[model samples]
Target: MPSMKNSSFYPSYFLLVGIPGLEHEHIWISIPFCITYAFALFGNLMVMFVILVSPRLHQPMFIFLSMLAGNDGLLCTSFTPKILSVFWFNDRAISFTGCLLQMFFIHSFTSIESGFLLSMAYDRYIAIYNPLRYSSIITSRLILRLVIVFLVRAVVLVGPCLILIKRFPAFKTNIIRHSYCEHMAVVKLADADTHVNSILGLLVAFTILGVDLLLILLSYTMIFNAVFRLPSARLKTFNTCTPHICVFLSFYGMALFSFLSHRYGKKIPPSIHIIFSDIYLLVPPMLNPLIYGIKTSLIREEMGKILWKH
Candidate 1:
C-alpha cells in the first residue's frame, strides 16, 4: 500500500496534481487553459449583457440563452481557478471540507446546466410554435420558478454524494490525479469498498444527461415536425435552431466524453482522461456563447453595440 499523508482515518487535505503524466508540460498547458478560461468568462458575460440590454432579445429564447450562459459561467468558475492555480503555482492542497464543497458545486452546476438546456429546448418549442400565445403566458415568475426548481433538484441529487463519501473511514492516499475534486477521483482514493460511491455518481450523471438528452430530443422532434409542416417557416426555423442544436451537441458531447472516459476507458491513458476532463469543464462555457454569437444575429448586433458603447 502507498504511504498516506494525513494523520488519522480522515485526511485533512487532498493534493491535486494538474494532470497525470503531463506534469512537465504544466507551464505550456496553463497557457491554453488560461486563455480558454478568460474567453469563457468574457463570452458568458457578453451573452448576459447582450440579452439584458437588448430589447429585441427579450424573448424566451434569448432569456433562456442568457440563463444558460450564466449557469455556464458558474459551472466553469466553480472549478477552473483551482486548476489554474495547481498548474501555475503548484498550490494543489485542498482541505477535506473544501474538496466536498467543490464536488458538490461542480456536480450541482452540471445538473443545472442539463436542466437549462432542456429548458432552452422547451423555450424554442414555445417561441417557434406558439409565440403569440406565450407572449402573455411566459412570465418572469415562471422563469424564476424554473431556475429554482432545477437548483433544488440539483442540490437534492448531488448533495447526498458528499454525505455518503463522508462516511468513508480511510483512504489509501491523500493524492488525487485530477486538478479538481471530482467525486469519482476522490472516491477512488478510499481504501474501502467504494461501489456505492461509484454507483451513485454514475447514476446521477446518467440520470441527468440521459434523461435531459431524451427530453431535448423529444422537444426537438415536436419542434421539427411543426416547423416542417410550414413551407416558408422551414428555413427560418432551421436558422434559428442552428445555434441551439450546435450548443446541445457540444455541451452533451463533451459531457458524455468526460463521463464515459472516466468510467469505461480504463485502457486509455490517464493524461488523456485528465485533458479531456479539463476540456469538458472549459469547452462548453467557452464555446457555447461563441456558438450563439455566431449563429444568432440579434446577439451579435447587440454585442457589437455594447462594445462600441464601451
Candidate 2:
C-alpha cells in the first residue's frame, strides 16, 4: 500500500477534486463567488441594520426576516472561505476535526433557516387568516419562544449526530473531494461501513428539510385558500407572499436538486454536480435578502432610510 504521506498519486479519483467533485479546477469561478459573497454579506447586513435600527421594522414579520438574514450571513461565512481557498490556492486539505465542525455548523444553520421559513409562513398565515388575532397569536413572548425552539432543534439534533459520526475510526484516506467539508464527503472517506451514518444523516435531513418543507407548503396552502376567499384582498395578499414564494421555491428547489444529485447523480458529469451543489448553498444566501428586502416596499423604504441616515 502506498504511504499516506505520498498518497497524492491517486489523481484519477480527483475527478471531483473536492466534495461534489468537479471535472476541472475552475479557479476563475472565485470571481463570481466573490461577487456573490460580497452581495450576500452586504445585503444581509443591511437587512439586519434596517430591522434593528428602525423601530418600524420591529414587528413579527421583520423580526423573523432579521433572523433569516442572520442565518444566511452565518451560513455563507461558514463555508465560503474554505471554498475560496480550494479554488484559489488548491488548499483542498481539511483536518478531521475541522471537517466535523464544518458539517455541524452547516447542518445547524440549514435547520435554523428551515425553521425561520416555517415561522415566516405561520406569520403570513396568521396575518391573512386571522388578521385581528395575528398580533396576539404571534406575540413577542411567543416569538422568543419559537426562536428558542428553532435554535434548540438545530443545535441539539446536529451536535449529538456529529458526535456519533466522530466515533468512527479514521483508517482510510482523509482527503475530501469537494470545495468545502460536507457531511457525506467526510463519510465517503471512512474505511468502516458508514451505512448507519448515512441512514441517520438522511433521517435528520428529512426531519429538518423535508418535514419542514411539507409544513411550510401546508401553511401556504392555507394562506392561499384564505386569500382566495377574500375577493378584493387577493392581490394585496399575493403581493405580500411574492417574496416568500420566490424564496421558498429557490431554497427548496435547489435543495432537492442537491440532495437527489448527491444520492443518485454519481453517473452524471461531476461538473454539473459541483455547480448544482454550489447553487444549493450559494444562490439562496445571495438572493434571500434581495427577495425579502428589495421586493417589499416597507423593507426597501426602511433600508433606504437607514442608508440615508448612515
Candidate 3:
C-alpha cells in the first residue's frame, strides 16, 4: 500500500494481470474465452444482419432485439480483444488514455444495455396488455428516441466518473489486478481520496440499474396479471416471454453475482473474482443471441433460411 503523493511523475501505462493467481493456466483458460468470443461475435452479427434484411422482423420487438445485438457486439468488442491479448500474448501494458477509453465504453455500454432491457420489457408489457395500441405506443420512431435517450443518459452519467478519475493526477500503482480496465479497479489504484468516485459509481449503479430492474419487474408483473385474466392468452403470453426471460435472467444474474463478489467477497480467491468478472462481461454477449436464436421461432427460422440458402 503506497501513495503517489511523493511520486514526481504519473504513470503513463497500466498493466493488466489476466488472472492474478492463475497465470500458469492462461492458455487453457483462454481456450473457452476465445471460443465464447468467437461465438458471441458471430452470433450477434448474424442477429443484426438477419434482422436488417428480413422484412418479417420489422416490428418493435425485433427492432429492439437488433439494437441489443449491436450493443452486445460492441460491448464484447470493447474488452475481449484486449483480454485475449493478455492471455495469449502477455500484452498487458495498456496506456493510461487507452485504459480510460476502455473503462468509459464498458460502463457506458453496460448502462445502455440496462436501459435497453427496460425498453424491451416495456415493449412486452404493451404487446401483452394493450395489444390493440401496441403498434402505436411502441413505434419505430419511439424506439429511436428511446435509444438516443438511453445513450445520452449513459454518457452523461459516466462522464463525471471519468472526470473524477482524471482529477486524480497520480497513482500508487499501475498494475490492475483484473483483466480489464473497470472503473472501480482503476479508481482503487489512485493515490488521492476516491470517496467521490466511489460514491458516484454506486450512485450511478443504483439509480440506473436499480431503477431499470424495478421497472422491468413491474412491467412483467402487469403483463402476468393481464395474461392470467384471460386464460386463453396465458400460453401465448408465456411463449412470447420465454426468450426474453431467459436473456434477462442470464444477463442480470451474472451481473449481480459479479458485483456482489467484487464488493464484498474480499476473502475469496483472486482467480475466482477475475473469472466471474470476465464471465459477467463475456457471457451475456455470447449467450444472448444464441438464446434468442433457439427460443424465438422467427429468428430461428430466419437463421435456418440463411443456412439453407448458403
Candidate 4:
C-alpha cells in the first residue's frame, strides 16, 4: 500500500515485485519460458486443429481432448506474458486490480482443466465398464452439456474467491517472488491480515484438487475392477489410456511436490522451490496434449493424415 517515489526499484516495481534490498534477477528466467511458450502454443494448436478437422476423431475422448486443448491454450496465454514481463522487463509489481484479474482467470482455466480431466476419466470408466453402451451414453448432447457444466462450475467457484481476494486493501510488500499471479503469491503480498483469504484458498484447493482427485481415483477403481474381468481385449482397451495416466501422474504428482515444498520444505533453496513450483504449474499444460496425441492411435493417424493432406 505504501509507495516509494523515485527509488531505484521504481521501474522494476511496476513490472515485478521488488524487495527493499535484494536485486531481482529476471533476465535469466525469460529465455526458457519463451521457448516453452512457443512449443506449448504449437502443440495445443495442433491438437485443436486435428480435432476440428478430423471427423473420425469426433468421439467423447477427442471431444474432451479439444476441451483440454482449449484450457491449455488459455492457461499458457494467461500466465506467460506477465511471467515474461516480470523477467524481461525487470518488473514484478502488478496493479491491485490487474493482479486480481490475473488470479481469477488463472483459477478459471485451472478449475476447468480439473473438471475436464474428471469428465475424461468418467468417459473412460463408462467406455471400459460397459462397452456395449459407450456410443449411446456419450452422445454429442451429453458432451455439450458436460462442457457447459465445466465452464459454469469453474465460473461459479472462482467468482466468489476472486471477490474475496479483491476486497483486501494492498498493504504489505508488492514484490511477488514467482513469475505470474498465483493465488498464494498475490495473497502473500497483502498488507492486511490474510486469514480469510488463506482459508478460502484452502477450500478452493480442496474442492478442485481433492474432489477431482477423488473422482478420478474412483473412476479408475471402477475401471480396474471391470478391466480385470475382461479378456485380452481389455488390455488393448486399457492401452488407450496410457497417455492420460501419464498426464495424471505427472500433473498431480508435481502439484503435490510443489505444494509440499512451498508449505513445508522451508529448508530448501528458494530457487529450487521456485523451479519445482513452476514445473508443477507449467509442464503439464504443455505436455498433456502431446502425450494424448502420441498415445491415441486415432489422433496420431489423424494428425498424420492432416499433415499429409496439408
lDDT of 3 by residue, 218-247 (tens): 998988888888668556766878788888
Q: Which ten residues in a row have the lowest lDDT in candidate 4?
A: 6-15
lDDT-wise, the better of 1 and 4 is 1
Task: Give per-residue CA lDDT, model 1, range 1-310, as digits (tens).
Answer: 2436555467888889879888989989999989999999999998998899899999877888988999899989999899988888888888899999999998888899999999888877877777677666677888889999999989988988999889899887899888799888898888789998888887887788889999999999988888887667555756788898999999899988888887799999999998998898788899999899998988888888988998
Tens-place lDDT digits, model 2, residues 1-310: 1224233222212112543444264566777888999899998998898889888888998898899999999999988887887777766666657777888888899899999998898888888888889888999998899989988999887877787667765535555566676777767766678898888888889999999999999998998788878777555856877888899899999999888987787897766776677778888998998898768898889877776877
Q: Rank the candidates by lDDT, best first.
A: 3, 1, 2, 4
What TM-score does each of the candidates earn?
0.94, 0.91, 0.96, 0.90
- Top-scoring candidate (TM-score): 3
Error of 4 at 229 (Å): 0.9
What do the candidate models score in CA lDDT, each in turn? 0.87, 0.79, 0.89, 0.77
Model 2, clash count? Answer: 6
Q: Any runs in candidate 4 off by more than 4 Å, and if so which?
A: 1-15, 18-25
Per-residue lDDT value at 34 in model 4: 80
- Per candidate, the number of residue pairs that clash is 0, 6, 0, 10
Candidates 1 and 3 compared by lDDT, better number: 3
